[model samples]
Target: MTSSRLAHEHDEHVCPRFHRAIELVGKRWNGAVIRALMDRPRRFGEILEAVPDLHDRLLSERLKELESEQIVQRRVYPETPVRIEYALTQRGRDLERILAEVERWAHRWLPQPSKS
Candidate 1:
């Protein structure tokens, strides 16, 4: 009946799914990379430019992780230079609704800076 106990019980039910999701997308720059690929396919350099703060090494690792998750696909064009592009898979696109909802919630409840 206590508030702490209630929160503990609620966490027990929510933490597994929450933690698993965080493990996948909460890693540094992972969410940004996903967002970058949301609209259309982008080349590796394009993704790096999209997330200006992310370093090349970390970006490479995150892309490989996403590819393994099946949320992203890596396509290689059989052209002269072997153009490579990264795109969001259908599974990745499924996060759009959830991301939009999160954005809405953050705008409502999170702090905003004053335009002094």
Candidate 2:
């Protein structure tokens, strides 16, 4: 048997749960939305402002997705105008360390964005 083929056979296997997680967080704007909420609970408008270039429709979709995933908690206040806030659930908050590590890695290896 070839040495390279033996090495390929012994390659580290990817966990299905981890792969699903990457798909979830790596979705467009999902990471940014999660990061925004990591600070604290926020209104819909606040999240929009926190993530520049994020469109209203897209944000709505992302929130619903996160909610379905049980990563974000959406609370509604019944009042005259009715208010809503989005916060991270414990499951979501659990991602803070992972996100922070990604942030650190980015800072070290990724280039800064060029101002237009």
Candidate 3:
């Protein structure tokens, strides 16, 4: 068989679990949250500010879901004032290349609206 066919056959045999993962990451706000964390770890409020238009409830839900999926890590610092920050896990970092590609595609094909 040709290499291309072999690759396609291999993908065909793969289970739906992998597809489910993609679906989860592909959820609307999930990708943005991952992209934001790609820059650096951020606190809840910092993420909220970064995604100003996102509703607070939705952000909380997304963060919790990502955490449950082992895609994000929540760290709490013990100090005079407690601090919490969210950072991407190894699995989440794996999305960087994919996200970059999507961004490139959007810039190339998605049109900008008129200023008026």
Candidate 4:
């Protein structure tokens, strides 16, 4: 095969970093949760409300995962109830354009969710 064909063939192979990124972003509800937070910082309850059918326990787990990845930051406020909020870090916000493109592609090509 020619060098250009060889290069194209090589590029067809899966990339480890790209695979890791897809796993992170495409994990169950991770994309939804991140998209919800794209607007602004939100309390745990608020995020729960934004994402339908997300259980509190699972949300907690997902937030912790994101936190570990440095994609989400948790903040504590000194209040009577000790309020906590979650916001996307710069790393997470950097995903906005990518996620938005995915959103657009989905809208164009993916089947629409059924209205129940």
Candidate 5:
């Protein structure tokens, strides 16, 4: 189907604010990062490994954006070398319920084909 047609289909099922929320979460690699963080805080290298396809520049930019929006918190430790980690803030934790629901929908409707 066309992009506009698919969008219209979504509009019929979602309100404007919820659609915008989905848009924010659906940005490139944003959802993947959020899903990764759902388990626990991760170091930058850990996150990079979890999202193997993510470019360092794009990942860094997305992390900073999420930090500015208060969705994620970045902690840096001072030492011989710097230690940094990213964890979800309370607001980000609130997204767990919504993300779970989306996960369920995806599992139900987007299942992968079984290998022969």
Candidate 6:
């Protein structure tokens, strides 16, 4: 088989899945949110705090998106304050290893800015 034909076949098989997964998880705040939930469940405020500089509105939207994607699960406690907690679903937990690998790659290839 020709190399160009193999390349084309591989792209046809892999590109859509790769692009779709990246498009979902690579959205702003999505990765950070996932990272925050990796340790344990968190309240909305905690997620915001875990992810530095994330806006309240953006965090809300991202959480909703992740929930819809089945990556994040939302639970509400019945109480006076009606606390809401977000946790990673099994699907989301599966990404932890992937994220760690990405982190390793970034540490190796990406240059860090000097702390001035």
Tell me each candidate's TM-score: 0.78, 0.88, 0.83, 0.88, 0.78, 0.84
- Give the per-residue lDDT digits (tens) of candidate 5, residues 27-105: 8888888888989999988898998679888989999988987999999989769889999999889999998998899
Residue 2: error of model 1 in Å?
26
lDDT of 4 by residue, 1-116 (tens): 79998689678997688789999999998999999999999999999999999999999999999999999999999999799999999999999999999999999999989888
Clashing pairs in 4: none
Name the better of 2 and 3 by TM-score. 2
- Winner by lDDT between candidate 6 and candidate 5: 6
lDDT per residue as tens, model 1, 17-103:
777887787787888899898889999999999987799999999999999999899999999989999999998898878777766
Q: Where is the poorest 10-residue window by lDDT in model 3? A: 10-19
Candidate 1 wrong stretches, greater than 4 Å: 1-12, 109-116
Q: What is the C-alpha lDDT profile of model 6 across 4-82, one tens digit per residue? A: 9979989767668777999888887899899899999999999989998899999999998999999999999999979
lDDT score at residue 43, model 4, on the 0-100 scale: 97
TM-score of 6: 0.84
Worst 10 residues of 5 by lDDT: 11-20
For model 6, what is the C-alpha lDDT against the true structure?
A: 0.92
The reply for model 6, stretches above 4 Å from the true place, is 1-8, 11-14, 114-116
lDDT of 2 by residue, 1-116 (tens): 89897677558676588789999999999999999999999999999999989999999999999999999999999987999999999999999999999999999999999987
Q: Which stretches of candidate 2 lie over 4 Å from their true place?
A: 1-12
lDDT score, residue 29, model 6?
82
Model 3, span 16-70: residue lDDT tens: 7767977998998998999889999999988988874788899999999999999
